[model samples]
Target: MMELDPAATFRQEAADLLDSLETVLLDLGQTPADRDLIDAAFRALHTIKGSGAMFGFDRVAAFTHDFETAFDLIRKGKIDANHDIVTVSLSARDYIRALIEAPDATDPIIGEAIVEELQRLIGRGDAKGAAGAAAPPAAAAGASLASGQGGWRITLAFEEQILRNGANPLALLDDLRELGPCTVLPDLARLPALADLDPESCLIGWTVTLAADCPREAIEDVFMFVRDEMRLAIAPLAEGVPDVRPGFTLDMAEAAAEPAAPRPEALSAETASHPLPGKAAPAPAGAELNRRAEDKGSTVRVQAERLDELMDRVGELVIAQARLSQLAHSGTDLAIKAIAEEIERLASGLRDSTMGVRMVPMGSLFGRFRRLVHDLSRDLGKPVDFVTVGEDTEMDKTMIERLADPLVHLIRNAIDHGIESREARASTSKSATGRIELSARYVGAQVLVTVQDDGAGLDTARIRAKAEEQGLVQPGATLSEQEIHQFLFHPGFSTARTISALSGRGVGMDVVKRTIEAMRGAIDLTTIPGHGSSVTLRLPLTLAIIDGLLIRVGEGRYIIPLSAVEECIELTAADEARSRGRSFLSVRGELVPFLRLRELFDAQGAADPHQKVIVTAIGGTRIGLVVDQIIGSHQTVIKSLSKLHADVTMFSGATILGDGTAALILDVAQLVSLGQGRADDRTPEAA
Candidate 1:
C-alpha cells in the first residue's frame, strides 16, 4: 500500500494557484482600479497560503501569508494598487512559485528581498492587514448588517486515481475545517475488501455540512486542484437536506465519529447520472450537452498518457475500418459495403470526439503572455499595449503545451528587437506606446495564430548584410525582403550588434521556426518596414489524425493533408513536354508552382502518361503536387517515423494503409519550401 505524498499534491496545486495569481496580477496591471481583479488576486494568494500550510509547506504558507496580507490591505484601501506595487507583487508571485517548486533549493535571501521590495513599494506601515487597521470596504461604509451564519451542504466524491494524482483528501478536509465549524461524514461503502484494495486509489467520499461566513468559492477552493478530479456539489443547507443540522459544529472528542447520511439539493435535476446514492432519471437523447454542462463541476481528471492510449486504440480501430472498407469494396454484397460505410462513419465520429477532448482553448496558453508583455515592456523602457482576439479558438492541448516555449521566445524577441525604442517611436510620430496583438482563428482544417507587433519591421538590409557576413549567402547576392527575413530562422543567425540576456543569442527565432515546422505547421512573416511586422503561423488543429488524400507517386504511395488540397487536375504529357522549361501551371489567371513527389523522393518508376496534379494551399499560397494515381481520401492515423528517419523532413509521418503498407504523410509546408527554387525560376505563386 503506497501512500501518496501530500507535498507533491501541494506543489501541483501551487503551480495552478500561481498561474491564477499571474493572471489576476496581469489583469490588475492593466486595470489597477478594478477591485474585482484585486479581490481575485487576494483569493488566489489566500488559497496558496492555507493549502500550503495544510500540506506541510510551511515556507510557502509563510511567504503567501504576507503576500495575501498585502493584497488584503489593498482590498481594504490601506494601500494603493498602483503599477509599481503590481510589479513588485508579480515578482513576489514568481518567487513563491520558486519556493513551492524547490523548497530546499530556493534561496531564502531572494524571497526576503522580494518581501522587502514589496514593503518598500507600498511604504513601511501600509502593507499590513492588522485588526486595528481600517475596516474593509464592505464594513467600512457601515453596511455591516450581520446575518445568520450560512449553513451549506457539500458532497465530494473523489476519483479513485486522486491519490495517485498527488492529491491529499485529508489535507482538503483540513482546509474545509479551517473555514468554519464543520461536520464531516465519510462514505466508505466503496472501500473494497483488503485483498482487492489498491492502497494508491482513493476510496473515500465525504459529506460535510459547514456553517461559515466565508464565500462559497472559498469552500470550493478546498479541492481546487482536484475540482476536475472529483464529484462535488454545494447547495444551501435548506430544509430536507438530510443529516444537515442548522448550525453544525464539531466537538474535538467526537470529530472522528461517523455522522448520519446528509445530501445536498437534489443533484440539480439535470444531473441524470448522479454519483451519489440518489436515483436520477435519464434525460432525452438531445439533452446530453445540457447534462454535461450541469455536471461540469464533477469532472474526472484523466492523465495525458491515458488520452494517448485511447488515441492509440482509436487509431487501431480506424486502421481496421480501412481494411474492412477495402474488403467490402472487393466484394459484391451491398449489405457488406453498407456495414463498412456505417463503421467508417462511426470511426469518424469517434475520432472527432477524441480530438475534441484534446482540444483546449488557445487562451489557456495565451494568458501567460500578458505577464510577459508587461514585464518586457517595463524592462525595455517601452510602453506596450497588448491585445488578443479569437482567444476562444481551440487547438490540440498537446500542441498548445509545446507551442508555449516557442511563443515565449518569439514574443520576447518581438518586444526586444522588433519594437522600436520609446524615443524612436516618438520620432516616427507614432504613439508612445506600441501595440502587440496575438490572435488565433480557425481557417478550414487549420488554426491560424498570428503574433503581430507594431514595431520597426524587419531590417532586410541588415539581415542580408549579416547573411553575407556570415557566408550564409553568396557575396553580392540579391535577396528578396521575404528571403532575407527567412535567414533569421537559420541557426546562429542574428543581426544584433551586441548580445543580451533576452535576444541576440541567435537561438530563439530559429527554435520557433523549428518547433512550428516540427508540428507540421508553416510560419510566414509579413512586414512593413517602419510600420510593423506580423508573423502568422498556420497549424493543423490536431496532429493525431487527419483526412488525407492518398496518392501514388511512381512506386511509392504518400498522403497530402486533405485540408491543404483544393482540387485536382489532369497534367497531360503534352503539357509537360510543351512546358519543358516551366515549373508552373496557369489556372484561372494564377501561376501555381508544382512539385513532383516522384522526383522529390527519387522513387524508381516512370511518370504516368497523364499525371494528376493535386492543387494544395499552405500559408495562402496554392501549389500543385504531381502524383500518378489519386487512390482516394483516407482517415490517416499518423504514426511518427523512427529515429533512423528523423532527418526526413519531406514526410511528416508514416501511416499504415489498408493493404498493410506504410505511406508517408507529406509535409506540405516543407515541400513548399523545397519547391522555392521553382518559384524563383517561374512566375511567383500568389500568396
Candidate 2:
C-alpha cells in the first residue's frame, strides 16, 4: 500500500486550477461574450477556493472568494465581462496563487492598491467597497437555511483492495461531517471472522446520512481522493424526513407488527423491491454513465521529462533492432528472416509513434507574441499588426521549447529597430500600420520557421561602414551584400546610436545565431532596399534521431543527414585532376563547391582513386563533400560532444554505428560556408 500525501495532491491540483484559469482568461479576451468561457473560469476559481480552504490555505481561500464573487456576477449576467474586469481578475488570480504559496509575503500597500483597482473595475465607487460589510440578519438566516437545509443519504463501498491504496473510509466520513452533520454506520456484513481476516484488505463498508445544504459536488469531493477505487451512491432524503438521520434505526413498525411466516421466494422479492432502511439504492442505469462520460474527456498531463525518457528508450530499441536485423541478414534460415522482418516492421512503427508523441503544434509558441506585440506597440507608439501563418505546423516539442526565447528576441528586434516611425514610413510611402509575419512549414524532412517584417530593411551601406569601424572588415574592403548583412549577427555589433530595453543593445542577435547553430540548425537572412527583411530558421525534425547518409572520408566516417542530401556522383581521376586548387566541380555545367572531408578532418588514410561526391544544399547554395566510400543509410541517434570538444564547429555532433564505430555528423551550413570561401579564394578574379 502506498500512502498518499494530501498536502502535495492539493498543491498539484491548485497549480492545474491556476493554469486552467489563465487559459480561460486568455480565451475570454478573444471572445468576451462567451458564456462557456466565463463558466469555466468561475468553476476553476470555485474549485480552487473550496480545495484551498479544505487543505488549510485559508488566506488563499479568502482572497480568491472576492474574485470568485466578481466572476459569479459576470456568469449570472449581473455585470458584463469587460476587459478591465478581466484584467483585474487576472491580477487577483496571481495574488491568490502567491497567497497560497507564500501567505506571509503579502504586502498591505500592494494589497490595498489591488483592492482599489478591483473596486474601481467593479464600479463600486470608493474605498468603502474594500471594507468588510455585513448583511441583514434575516438575509443571513435565509442564506444559512438555504445552505444546510437538506439531508443526503450516501452509501460508500470500496473494493477489497482499497486499503492497498492507503485510504481510510472513516477519514472521508469525518470530512463529510465538516459540511454540516453526518451520521456514519459501518457495515460488517463483508468483514471476515477475526481468525481469517486479512489486515491489508478493506473488510468494511459504510452508510452515511449527511444533513447539509451544500451542493452534491461538495459531498463527492470528500471522496475524490479514493474515487477511482471506491463505489459511491448518493441520494437526497425524501421531502420532510428529519427523523431519518444516518444512525442505526430499525423501523419500529416492521419490528412490532411483522412476525408473520415468510415464504423464502416472496421474502426475497420484497427485499429486492424495497432496500433495507438507511441502505443506498442499487446501481442505476446512469450510475456508471458519468464515469464513462468523463473517461471520454479525460487526458493525462505528463511532464516533459517523462516524454524525453520514453524517447531515450525508443532510441535504444531502434539500436537493438538494427543489431538484430544485421544478424538476421547473415543467416540462411527462412523462419529467422521472416521473424526478423516482422520485428523490423514493429520497431519502425514504434519509432514513428514515439516521434509523434514528441511533436507539438507551434501555436503555443505563437500565442505569446500576441501579448508581446500588444505591449510593444503601445510602448513605442507604433501601429503594428503581427500576423502568423502555418501555426498548425508541428515540430519536436523539445525544439519548440528551445525556440521560444530566440523567437522573442527576433520579434522584439523587428518591432524596436526594424520598423521605422510612422513619419518615416509615410515619407517612404508605406502603410502606417507595419506588419510582421511569422510563418512555419515543413521543408523536406526539416521544419522551416520564418519571421518577416514589413519595415525598413537592413541598410547594406551602413552595415559595411559599421563593420569597417568595428574592424570586422578591412579598410576599403569591397564586400558583397551578403557579407555586409551577415555583420548584423556579429557579437556586440549594432547600428543603433542609442540603446533601449527591447533591443538596440546588440546583445541578442548573436545569441540567437549561436543558439540556432547549437541546435544543429541554420539561419539565413534576405532583404530588399525598400521592402522588409525575412529571417528563416531551418532545423531537423528531431534532435534524438535522424536518417543519416553514412560515408567515409579516408578512414574516418561522417554522417550527412539524409534530409539534406540531394544526390551523389562519382568523381573520376579526370574530374578530380581538373579541379585542383579550386574546389568547384562542373556537374552538367553547374558550378558546385567541393570539399575534401579527408583534408578537413585530417584523416590518416590515403584518399581512394575512385571517390564519390555527395552534393547537398543549404538555402540556395549547393556544396559537395568528397568521401572514400558510401556506407549507405543509417538511423543515427545523436549524442552531443563533451564540453571539451564544444569549440569544434565543423562536426555538429556524433552518433554510434551499429558496429560500434563513431561517426561525426556534418554541420552542412558551416561546411558550405567554408567550401564557398575556399572556392572564392582560388578564383582568378578574387586574386
The candidate scoring highest on TM-score is: 1
What's model 2's TM-score? 0.73
Off by over 4 Å in 1: 1-5, 125-298, 333-335, 475-478, 620-622, 678-687
lDDT tens per residue, model 2, 67-169: 8767766754456777667767767777877776777987656656776787677775233333323445766765543333467767666666655544556
Clashing pairs in 2: 147-213, 148-213
Q: Report how far residue 88 has shifted in candidate 2, in Å.
A: 3.5
Quote the positional error of residue 673 for candidate 2 in Å.
3.2
Evaluated with lDDT, which candidate comes out highest?
1
TM-score per candidate, chains pooled: 0.77, 0.73
lDDT of each: 0.77, 0.74
- Over 4 Å off in model 2, which ranges? 1-12, 93-112, 124-298, 383-386, 419-434, 528-531, 577-580, 679-687
- The root-mean-square deviation over C-alpha atoms between each candidate and the true structure, in angstroms, is 8.5, 8.4
